[model samples]
Each structure stands twice: as C-alpha cells, then as structure tokens.
Target: MNSRRDLLKTVGAGMLLKLIPVGAFAADLVKFVDVRLWPADEYTRVTLEHAGAIKYKHFLIENPWRMVIDLLDMRLDTTLKDLTSRLQADDPFVQQIRVAQYDANTVRLVFDLKTEVKPEIFTIEPIAEYKNRFVVDFYPKYPNDPLLALLQKEDPMLREDEISRALRLAEAETNGTLKLESGSAGSAPNTEVAKTEPNAPVNSKPKFEVRRMITVAIDPGHGGEDPGAIGKGGTYEKNVVLAISKRLKTEIDKMPGMRAMLTRNGDFFVPLNTRVKKARSVNADLFVSVHADAFIRPTAGGSSVYVLSERGATSTAAKWIANKENASDLIGGVNIKGTDAQLAKVLLDLSTTAQINDSLKLGDAVLGNLGKVNRLHKPRVEQAGFAVLRAPDIPSILIETAFISNPAEEKQLTNAAHQQKLAEAIAKGIANYFAKNPPVARTPLT
Candidate 1:
C-alpha cells in the first residue's frame, strides 16, 4: 500500500510540470540603438548608446591585449552590426571590433588592440540629444608629457633679458629712448632670417625687440562631435571658426619674433579644460579663442569680444552666452568620470585680477578692430566668466566672429574672403596690443 502511494505522488508532479511554457523562463532583451567611436591622439573612445538601460561587464584578455565587453540579456542586433563600418584604419589603439552571441542571452564584443592599453570604462546618464552612453576609453599606461609636446614644437616665450631688451627698444621708440627707422612688415632685422609670404608685408616696424620668440596660442572653438552652432545655410560653427583661426595663425606666423600654435588643427573634440591647459603648457603670451555665435532670435546678430569677469557677467545676455559656451563639454561627450575634479576646481578658481585686467585690454583692442570688419554687438568689451579664458597667468580673450544664427551674418561668416579679413583684423589687434603692452619677463617653466 505504501509503495503504490509514493509512485502516484511522483506521477502527479510530472504531469503538472508539463503544463508550463518554455518561453516563460527566457531573460528580458535590451536593444542597442547607436554606437560611436572617437579616436584621438590623447585616447581612443568607444561609446554604446542604447534605448534602454543595459547591464554589462568587461574583462581584459592577455597575449594579444584584447578587451571583451559582454552585454547581459541582449541579442545581436543591426544597430550593433553597424559598428564595423565606423572603424577607421588609422585608429591609434583598436585594431578591429568583433561581435558574437556568447551564450543564449548575452552578446559579446571583443576589441583587438594595436598595443598595450590602460582602459577606462564608465556609463553616463542620458543628457541632451544623447541617450544612455556606455563609454570605453583606451589610455596609454604612460600618458605623453604636455611639456614635451610644447618642446617638440617651437618655444613661444622670450627669456628675461630678451624681454628687457624688447621693452627697452619699445620704450625707446615711444619715449624717444632710441630712434629706429620704421621698416615695412616682413622686413627682417639684421639679426635674423625672415620667412615672408609672397603677397604679405614683412614686419615693417617692429617697435618691440624681444630677445626670445613670443608664442601665441590660437584656439578654434568646438570640433569633432561638437558641431557648435549650426547656420541655416548648413555651415557648421566648428568648420568656420577653424578656418578663421587657421587664417589668424598664418598671419601671426609671418610676424617677426612672434610664433603661433593652434589648439587643434583638425576636426576633433578637445575638452575645454584641456584647451586651457594647452595654452598654459606652451607658456603662451596671449590666448585667443575664436568662435561664431548663435542666438534664439534670428534678428539678433553681431560680433563680440569677451574677457573673464571676476564677479559676474557684464550683462544678462553675456551670462547666457557664457553658459551656452560652457555646455560644449557635455555635448561633445567628455569622460567626466575620468576627469580630475581637484584640477578642474583649481582651474575654475584660478582667474586672477591681473589676468582679467590684461584680458580687458586685449579684448578692447580686438573688439575695436572687429568693428572695422563686422558689426559690433556691443560697443565696449563684454565681460563674462568664460571657462576657456580662465588661465590665471595667461592673458586670454574669446572672440565671436559673427552671429551664425542670423541669415545675413551666416553668409558673411561662410565667405572665405570675409574670413580672411576677420583674421587679419584680429592679427592686427594682437600686434597693436603687444606693441604697447610688452609681455613681462616670465621665468622658464621647470
């Protein structure tokens, strides 16, 4: 009787299990909407932007130095497949990307690396036009020294004695300390060889005599993923500003005893803080950030120059403009998690009274010159708390070449000839400022 009861109980349990569906046990799926890759000299970044939240894990593989990323509860989708088309042959780190279904409910990604890399992985919550972003950055274990980069290029600052001699010569020209014949621009002094453009004039009258080369850092605002303000005619702010900045660089390059370095020479995203650090690294005598502005009202248009305000912005519009410019890092997708908070804080708090004073003079000179070529938004130099201009020791100014949102101004900005004119105006302004206010002799950086 006991054996019969036990066998009946086992039969009933088996019958009940067969009634359940197999699909009920499957995991929930996560869809991938987009993937982007940004390969820069600083590091290589791979971003997976998806519709829904994702659960993922990554690990390093040896011998070949591959990075494996596994997404849980996800299947291979077309969006993920498109990642292959985005790979560039010139990528500094990643050789290629491979995707496969690692198991029943997980999709895996393998990154073939060109060399050993220190990888940083983090996730950013959805912001602006972006969805949830899973970011992977391959940074070299040993980052390159910024000073080394400066040294690799031509040094842009003068020694103490050089500055003193230049000052004495300048004072002599103005204070009647000495009377030297004013030579046409492009004409070299007896001491040095001059490289002049075929159509350009040489340094006709160099009132300031610097013993060492004077370096200026020209920064073109917004690039790479950051398109900046878009014009109605389809001109991108990044491209326009870059063109203008490059023209300005060429003009500055031709000046005797003065050299110029660009913050970026290509279409790539550079962090705002990095831009500041770059100016400092090269020991720039002056920093000029070139940009094209946009406004909510299409009728609102004109060029403006801004210097850092120690307290508050000069006007409400100035504050709004500053806030908008500061948003580039967010739109361009900075790896905020990897940023140095302390360093960033220091940069933000670094604006000194002397820096602002010098910046105002520079802004006035540029603003005055800009009016000659383009309509001035404000008659006087505007003051705002612009992050790119916060290099405490460097005299910096931000110039808005024109309002790209305005139909008329957009046309002006897009014209190559107009761009050259703007560049020349700015170069002239810089030359004027340096002529009167010679840079003080700074100790060489260790």
Candidate 2:
C-alpha cells in the first residue's frame, strides 16, 4: 500500500514532467512558420514566427543589406515549402530563400541575394500607444563589380577547418589541457601608399606573392541554457547570434588566408572568462564578439563597436550598456565565483596597459573597414568593460550588429540575404585590416 507522502511525491513528479515541454528535451523545440522575402521598391522585408513567449528581437545590418527576426516564446509547426511559396516570382531584390531547423528551439531562414545593401533590425514592445513589433529596413547600395567575384568564389570548408583547430585549442586550455602565452608576436603593420605609373607596355614585375593565414575566434555571444537577451518578438539572443556566427564562419572559410572558430557551437552555456580563454588558447589573431543590441528605445537602428574599457565606463550610457551585457551570465545561471575568480585576476594583471592600446588600434582598423561596408552609429569606436573582450593579448572587438528592439530593424535581421551581406562586410573589414597589417611568422625549430 502506498502512503499519502508517496502518492504526493509521485503526483509532483508527474506534474514536473508535464511542465517540461517536449520541445525542451528534444534537440530543437522551435519550428519554422514562414520565411519569405517581401520586396518593396525601397526595401525588402524578411519575416519569421515561432512558438514561445516574447523574449527579444535582433537586427543585423552591415552595408548593402539588412536582416531582422522576431523571436517568440512558442514553438513552430509549419513547413518550409509553405513559406517559400510566398515569395513572388516578380521579386527582384532577393536572390533566393533557404529555411531549415537550427536546433530544437530555433529555425534558420536564409535569403540569398543578387547584390549588397545597407540594412537595420529592431523590436518595439507594447507601449501606451503602440503594439509589439519586430521590424527590418534596408538601404540600397551602388553596385561594386569587384564584390561579385569575391562572393562567387567564397568557400566554407576551409573556414571550418581553421575553426576546428582553434576550437581544439580553446577546449584544451579551458579544461587545463593547454598553457599559452600573451606576448605580441605579430602586431598589425602599416601599408605603403600606392602610386600610379604610365602603362607603356612595360613588362610589370610579377606581383610579389605573399602567403598569410590568420586564426580568428568568433564568439556568437549567448548559448545553451543562457539566452542572452529576451526580445519583444520572443527571439533568444543566444540562438540568433549562433546562427549568424555559423554563417560568418562559412564565409570566412571561403576566404583564402583566413579561418574562424566559434566559442560555443551549440546550445551549451559558456562563462565570460571561458570565451577569452578559447580565443587565447587557439592563438587567435583577432577576436570578434557578435551580438544584437536591445534597448528601451525601439527607434535605435544602427550598429556600434566596442573595445575594452580601461577605466570602466566613462559615461552613464556606457555604464548602462555594460550592465546589460554583463547580466548575460545571470540569465545563463553561471557560477562565476567557482570558475572565473582566479582566471579573472590573472588575465587582468597579465592584460598590461599595452594590450588595451593594441586592442584599440585593432578596433579602429576593423571599425574603419566596417564603416566602408555599413552605416555606423558613430564615427569613432565606443569603449565598454565587456567581459567577452577581456582577453589580455588578442585584439578584440564586440559588435552590436544592430538593435533588436526596433521593429523595422528586427525584420531586416531575419533575412538570410542581409545576414550574408553583414557577414561579408565583417569579413571584408577583417581582410582589409590584415592586408595592411600582415602578421609576423614564428620561426620553427631546426
């Protein structure tokens, strides 16, 4: 015979099991509703919907394109064909559409494109007068013939190989399997000014061949149990950034002399300290931390870049932003005291005043290249005490791709084509920076 206590316990266990949605245990809980490229003469709109409560919105806009996605707290139960058919045959802006499940809780909608375009994404929460919204907007750019050839020949396999090597390094270091250095071996260099000469059938000396490959660590922000930010459209910052990071990796792989590694590839949560550890372990030359900004104002519609903060935040606005970004661990339920205190102290002490200076220079170079491809929030790079940017040696920058809080920008961020453009711009910025500032090679033991 069962006692009252036993029955109660059994009932409670059943209730708990019921509470855990089937989607949670399954690898991917989210489903795709519809992903379509709705084009207007002025801009193109790419929309997404899924199951779940409203968490957040995201916008990714570099130059010549934009992407926005609304994250819902609900699950999806739609088919890919159902959504793809919505794209009209007459639409000229979007080149193609691709949709697939990213994970148990997320779906990816990719938009292929014919050309680059400037873009923005944002989310609007219900206010006294307005309803909730996730929006994306676009700003067209003039054609660049050189860009076409570059995109056509892009490769994803080579990029993944580099990323795999870096990940192994990161994992080894995180698990105490590897010890690394923070010295400045190969600092970015300056470029010689170009001069034009008359072409009089002079047999030009064959262009000097230089082979340089850079190892970069690309962190997709939040992941696993830690949803970085909750958007008005129920989008999780972790899932969204991861998708973008993977796309960025694909493009980076396509390049000839560059490779990228992700900090955390799946839904597992990673501590702030661990992020930098991974970058340093792999001897990453540059660290680009990708994120979608969220704010009280839904109207904020531009991307911002940040290097490490030397003296904390200089202003109230900076402080606020820092606080929000730092809160990511809280959502992910991190045991900071248990894992990071010692490493934090060591990294800070080892992170000499000079490393910060190098980081700033790297930020400037990347930002300058970014400006060439996208609309920037400010002409100068912003500084904030971002934990993700704490690597003592790596030249690191955190990019707020765009605001997920603004409705117009949010729509653009979900568009696959725009995401590709954003990826291209970032890649281009990195390439340009490296071209001018080639890395010094380490001598091998004879």
**Count of backbone clashes for each model?**
11, 64
Off by over 4 Å in 1: 1-30, 155-211, 443-446
Q: Residues 97-177, candidate 1, lDDT per residue (tens digit)?
A: 999989987899999998889998877777777788787888887876554454444435645454445444544433443
Which portions of model 2 miss their true places by more than 4 Å?
A: 1-212, 441-446
Tens digit per residue, CA lDDT, model 2, 338-384: 46687788776664465567666767776776666557766777887
Whole-model Cα lDDT of every candidate shown, in order: 0.81, 0.61
Q: What is the TM-score of each candidate against the true structure?
A: 0.78, 0.52
Q: Top model by lDDT, which number?
A: 1
Candidate 2 least-lDDT 10 residues: 188-197
